[model samples]
Target: MNDSHSAELLRYAAFTADPAGGNPAGVVLDATGLDAADQLAVAADLGYSETAFLTPAAAGGRAFAVRYFSPRAEVPFCGHATVAAAVALAERIGAGELLFETKAGPVPVLVEAGPDGVLAATLTSVEPHVEPVAAADLTEALAALGWSDGELDPAFPPRVAYAGARHLVLAAATRARLAELSYDFERLAALMTRLDLTTLQLVYRESEHVFHVRDPFPVGGVVEDPATGAAAAALGAYLREVHGVQEAELTLHQGEDLGRPGVLRVELRAGDPRIRVSGTAVPIGPRRG
Candidate 1:
């Protein structure tokens, strides 16, 4: 809450209209002058799972160069942060389309007005790719997570999926299994780091297109992330590409286990390879010292 960022920094809870719900994000609408360490300092001070910094893209015209940082490190992409930033921009500049040039690629985000002055954004991810997980690594992941192969859902299997960032998708056999989370933090973080993973997308299918998901984000220096849009995007691609669902709309319920409930809507088009993840955001006022 320094005076320098008094106007530059904005806090918001993304994926929910209520400020008390969703994942909190620190937003620097214009961080054109901040260096890597400066941005990291801002993010670490806020202590949100991730914070987004925006600077005008060199190409310009409603396009911005966006960077995302967790408390511990910089990431190639971050879904909830993107949604948070887009909504912040929309509120300031009025609802419309925006282009974000991320480290992963250029992502297009569409912002729209919602009921009773609420605003939401749907961001189309960079073309995604799904890859098979190494059996040994998967075994290590399960061991580190204190989960067993018998507890896994064979339907979904396991895969390393990427929409904007990478996530290891692991489906639990039941909702109960997904809810009971306890793991060796350092072990999992080491495994995730070696595999270049953003999170371990632990999930349980509630229905055909509805899922209950949780993300262990130790690599980001957090025990768990309440709402993870990047993992949601990765899951959408996993279902379509691996589960063989041609086109679908999926709903991911997250953060409820943490008492900060949030919802993320993920969509996939038949011909379009890009995954669209949508969610609402509400401002959380400014940070306090």
Candidate 2:
């Protein structure tokens, strides 16, 4: 297919209303002809952490089949990409409910226009689960991150959490511990490759409902992610499972150290296992020729 008929590419910064903040993502409104290699090439050219490709499914249904690609490879699911796609669609087709058939599962997204006419998107993930981290793995990860066992928070132990993709959740004892993020990238990338991890979800709980987080995304060919929606969902699930947090709402502050501050909102229901991640997105600008 020719480029003209394939799809319209839109760029947006997700998880933050400001274009200067949050993670940027490329959204293909109708990727009916692009193959996997083409998608990868597009993602590589865009140079975003990840990009979303959307195609209409069989029948006249509104639900779409979505695929996510990083510069290096395809991921099972991507939260920021989903948010970007939702907002892009809303801008063109009007705000409403949308469904995405992803490699992990069906993700439901809600889109609306804010008071200032900015688009906001929210996605409810598939059932989330948490698993205990092996001691040896934790030790190796800590070593790679230059973090000692004593620096970890006793209340929040390390664990592997999954909303769509697996992430290692490590809580810091202090915010300073979270900010000092120099690490051996190659070593952490190798370890993440061995364990099939996407990113390391490092967090510091500021209060019962507020937290600060950073994501080391070595596996995605990026040193760090300014805003990570998938990891935020996984963290919400982990908190609910380990701490029995019955609260329905939580907030995450991220990307401050990177100078790109983004906020992610996580919602948990008492009976539902799915976690909801919400944020606003704004256009980055026109696509490159």
lDDT against the true structure, each candidate:
0.91, 0.91
**What is candidate 2's lDDT per residue for 34-119, written digit by digit as tens?**
88888888888888899999998663466889999988889999999999999988887889999999999999999988898888
Report the C-alpha displacement of residue 111, candidate 1, in angstroms: 0.4
**Model 2 steric clash total:** 0
Each candidate structure's TM-score, on Cα atoms with residue i matched to residue i, is 0.96, 0.96
> What lDDT tens digits, residue by residue, belong to model 1 across residues 81-101?
999999999988889999999
Off by over 4 Å in 2: 1-7
lDDT of 1 at 118: 88
